[model samples]
Target: MSEDLPALMSYLDGLPEPHIVFDMDYRIVSANTAYLREFAQGQDVRGQTCYEVSHRFQAPCDQAGESCPRARALVSGQRERVLHLHHTPCGEAYVNIELAPLKDRRGRIRYFIEKMESLAHHHGAPGEQGMVGRAPAFRATLEMALRVAPSAASVLLLGESGTGKELMAKAIHEASPRASAPFVVVECASLSETLFESELFGHEKGAFTGATSARVGLAESANGGTLFLDEVGDIPMSMQVKLLRLLETGTFRRVGSSDLRHTDVRVIAATHRPLREMIAQQQFRVDLYHRLSTFPIRLPPLRERREDIPLLADTLLARVAPLRHLSIAPAGQHRLMSHPFSGNIRELRNVMERAALFCDGDVIELSHIEQALAADAWESGAPTALAVPMVSAPVPALPGHRQAQADAALWEAAQAHRGSRAELAASLGMSERSLYRKLKALKR
Candidate 1:
């Protein structure tokens, strides 16, 4: 048995991907050189449990509420695959895990082989740009995107407005095999029927009023890469059949020319509207929907994955003010997390940008965030639903008069509220700890 371990290690060492062999008890029996360099930083991990080495958890992944591949392999006695956020040397990363069960002559499960492929294009933590999330919902959606990236199938991204559908589409494109080719975007909602066709499939010289010269369409431009149809639901009914034909046949004719052209491109379509409703209402075609939805991935809204708020806020702040080196105070972070963020990531970006502009110093406080949100709501013509009642009492003349008045108003609101501290804090557009800080500030 001991000699067999060396042979197994030698065999795995030749593989490029990270591989580790662990006993049924989950103890790391051996790690290949690739695994050592990628995950363990050349450290010996012979006796450590997989859970400890990968997640720093005392319990197994299944017990910790994660879908454990090893447990599933044990039951099925076959290979199992799962997407996992593993703690790597650099930081947390999304890795595709493939686990295969190893059995002895007696058909008894002895050890398991786990192979890990890191998703370099996506991040489990906040990055300078690109996808940043660790919430289970986001991870599930990301897994679907990654799984379908290598295939030639079409992808339909369904999500609410401002939920980062375009960003998700870009991620799929960058991860796909056609990454080296051009990625062309066609805004379906903004174009007329004639323009849509002309933009999508090109036009010959003098095809229409503006066709003075031969124009290459987006389909030709994205011949070897990806064509992203944003707001795809808005594509006119008259044009659906043409788009459907192009998708089904992989060929299309220019607006004026009778000659057909071919394109080797992957289609990624996104829409915020209800497509099923459109189909029922006869606004969208059923066949086109089927053609575009070879693999549909729903991007979880910001509210569904509130756990990612802090990470997203920090990342957005960095992008909003890369030169200022600004930071959000704990209270400001709490206030941000408590808000509804109705516009999702785009709205969050606006809030951070506004807050950065409002901050006179390096640190953004709760007051600055509140002002920014209020300004946004006002500029958008939204009612002042969160306006706290003014303090009727007079304030004596004092230094920092504006600060004193603001503190007085906050103190009055906190005292007048007749609900739980958490409820009051939320109603006041802040966190409980921030509420406590305001009261403490009043005392001083």
Candidate 2:
């Protein structure tokens, strides 16, 4: 049977339904064209572990609480079948999956043949827009988002920076009853206190010094739709009361206008900041926090769900590669998986974008990743020693040698210790003021 595996794969590929073969370890050995077209987007999926390709999981299906046909087939020595809600390229799909154990000459189970028949007519699973992941943490968040999408509840998204809070907010908007209405976004961090009211509630013609004509605020503009407040935690303490009133009453007066106006906008706020801590410190209003947190959803960071790294990298590459005309090599993907990704998905995107630019050929290599990581390290004041090799040769003292060495040392130290200027100065055994002076001189 092992010797005929190739012929068997060819036979399976000719079938109409999706078929796949995997070993006891759940490593996918072969997948039919139907499976590849539907799941892999026609990309090469050979040698990929089933968890990485199908479920985007780190472990076997049984470990992830999904019904494992392979386990059942192995135990009973009979065909096992189950209905599963699979995440496919088209969308979430309900499929009847059948698993039959393939035996060897010694009557030992060497592989399990999986056949999937679409049950979309039986159960329609909602598509998860572009949110990619099958990890429990990610799945939980996605479920919560989908559940709250149909409601009129004011959702508050909480997560670290670069955790795709905006994407989740958009997903909610897309899934909501007000899907046809506007989906406006307001960057709270970029909006100044003086402009916050005008930006949110709008103003009448000549209402203020800069108001030349009638203007509609984001809240009013998003009437019957969603108004996404990005970095909601950054809303000024002085303006928290105003925001609270708007949320509570669905009414607001424009800046310098006495006329009260009403809007039917759904609010979806997101922030990376710790609002509870802010409330304790009196930096943020407690009432506002409570009002905005009616449906708080926390997005998991990339580091917490490392198993989704491969799928995420592939998805990102699919979107970015065509623009740059570059594909990621196996080594590049492995390199990405090893990264800590402190900045989460945003950091990963940055690395991919940089690698795409660095790669001359169609395929991105390990060297491109190394170069991108080194450049990012330099910019962020992170350690570059690992990404970029240091010069092993000794420096010779000559005319202007001391200044040159000092510049090189300062640059290297900056890469090693990415922090405040005071910290960098202290690490270099110099006063903060002196460090500033040296930086200026170096610029000259």
Q: Local distance difference test, per candidate?
A: 0.83, 0.76
lDDT of 1 by residue, 358-416 (tens): 67677776666666666654565553323432212222222364365446546655544
**Candidate 1: residue 1 lDDT (0-100):** 45
Worst 10 residues of 2 by lDDT: 389-398
lDDT of 2 by residue, 1-444 (tens): 779899999999999888889887777889999988877888877778876776677887789878777778877999987656676886665556778999999999998888886533222232223667756677677667766877999999999999999988988898789989999999999999988988998888888797899898999999999999999988998889999989999999988788889999899999999999999999999989889999999999997887777667666666666555456666556656656787899988787777677666566655565566657666666553233222122222223543454465465555555467775554344567976887787777
Task: Quote the lDDT for 320 in model 2.
Answer: 67
Stretches of candidate 2 off by over 4 Å are: 1-64, 67-129, 323-325, 384-444
Model 2, position 53: C-alpha lDDT score: 78
Model 1: CA > 4 A from native:
1-7, 384-426, 429-444
